[model samples]
Target: MKIIVDRFISDSESTISHISVDQRFVCFGLEDEFRAIKVLKETRIPAGTYKVALRTRGKHHQQYIERFKDIQHEGMLEVLEVPGFTDILIHCGNTHTDTEGCLLVGTSAHTDPENMSVSSSSIAYRKLYPLVVGAAKNGSLSITLEDNDR
Candidate 1:
């Protein structure tokens, strides 16, 4: 599976993006603002291609399994080996403040200069999780993060 995140709008506090899988639209994504100097929990990962996998262990995993009981949750969709970052996962949230450096997904998006947000987050996540897990099962999964929406 090939996932692409087009980070189109970036500001002081948030980066708003759209996500696609295998050239098909998936959802909107939200991440922390890009920063030359990395700040823990507040900086977006660098633009790069990274392998993705299902992280079966972690607090996020445990929480998701419970919260998404109807989805047959496999594991968190983790973006692997991002330089200077760890435990980067594609999950769900409403705003940049909820991201904590992880990618957040939603059905709809809104962006302003300093604040970016998304809505219907859990609904988006429920729709996305299975597709990623199925891909992981069938073959390889990877994601390319880029600033292409300019």
Candidate 2:
């Protein structure tokens, strides 16, 4: 399955996760886990195909490699050559700037951009958590910046 995570909606972003399961590709919304019913978000990577790669930062490095290995081992999704090297993968961030060079997903259990006591309540988790969880469960998600009414 060639899963495409398109972000072409208004006021939010979207993410598509492909999990390796018994030599098969399972593309779904990461947000589905939380029973989220909405899709799409602000700031998208435009309409184009890009190669997916793993960009690990810290301790999760091992987990990131495992994910890529699983994908290749199962023959589910193959990495492609994207112009300008726009690599996308699971990373940590709370806002648009957090994305930096890659797709910024939910925040980590330890690091919350805000100093607030409630980490989960942070903007990152509150907005991205539900969306990603839903995507993972649904097997495909698109994020857009355009209003539905428009």
Candidate 3:
């Protein structure tokens, strides 16, 4: 499966993106700000294609299992070989604050009263997880992150 993230919004606090699979719209994504000088948990992953897989065991996997007990999945989706980054998983969250240099999936993007960007995270994640798992059944999944700002 080939997933594409088109990052159209680049701001000081976060980047909002639209995600698609094989030309089909899937979800919105929220990531931390893009900075010339990268800061831990405050910088978005570089735009590039990365191999993705479902990890059955790891800190993220365990955490997801704990958080979403009703979701019948064995592992979390992991973006592999991200240069200078580790443990980058495409998981659930609403805002940039919820991510630590990882991708957050959401159904829709909105600006809150506090002026922070957020999304309908859990619903989108639940919708995404199964599609990814189904795709992985055929073969390895890959994602291409494109910076539209450029």
Q: Give the number of the best model, judged by lDDT.
A: 1
Rank all candidate structures by their lDDT, best first, as comma-separated numbers.
1, 3, 2
Candidate numbers, best TM-score first, in rank order: 1, 3, 2
lDDT of 3 by residue, 1-150 (tens): 888999887666788888998778889988887877778887898999998877787777888887777767768888889888877889888777888989999988774423446467888887777777767555578999999954
Candidate 3 regions exceeding 4 Å error are 66-71, 111-116, 137-139
The C-alpha stretches of model 2 lying farther than 4 A from their native spots are 10-44, 53-80, 106-150
Error of 1 at 62 (Å): 0.9
lDDT of each: 0.87, 0.32, 0.81
| Per-residue lDDT value at 53 in model 1 | 83
Clashing residue pairs for model 1: none
Compare candidates 1 and 2 on TM-score and give the better one: 1
For model 2, residues 1-150, the per-residue Cα lDDT tens digits are: 133332212222323332222233322222111112422332334335443332334444554446435332212121234333333343444444444334443323221222211122233323433334334434443332111211
TM-scores for all candidates: the values are: 0.94, 0.33, 0.87
Q: Tell me how candidate 2 scores on lDDT.
A: 0.32
lDDT of 3: 0.81
Q: Residue 52: error of model 3 in Å?
A: 0.6
For candidate 1, the TM-score is 0.94
C-alpha displacement of 27 in model 3, angstroms? 0.9
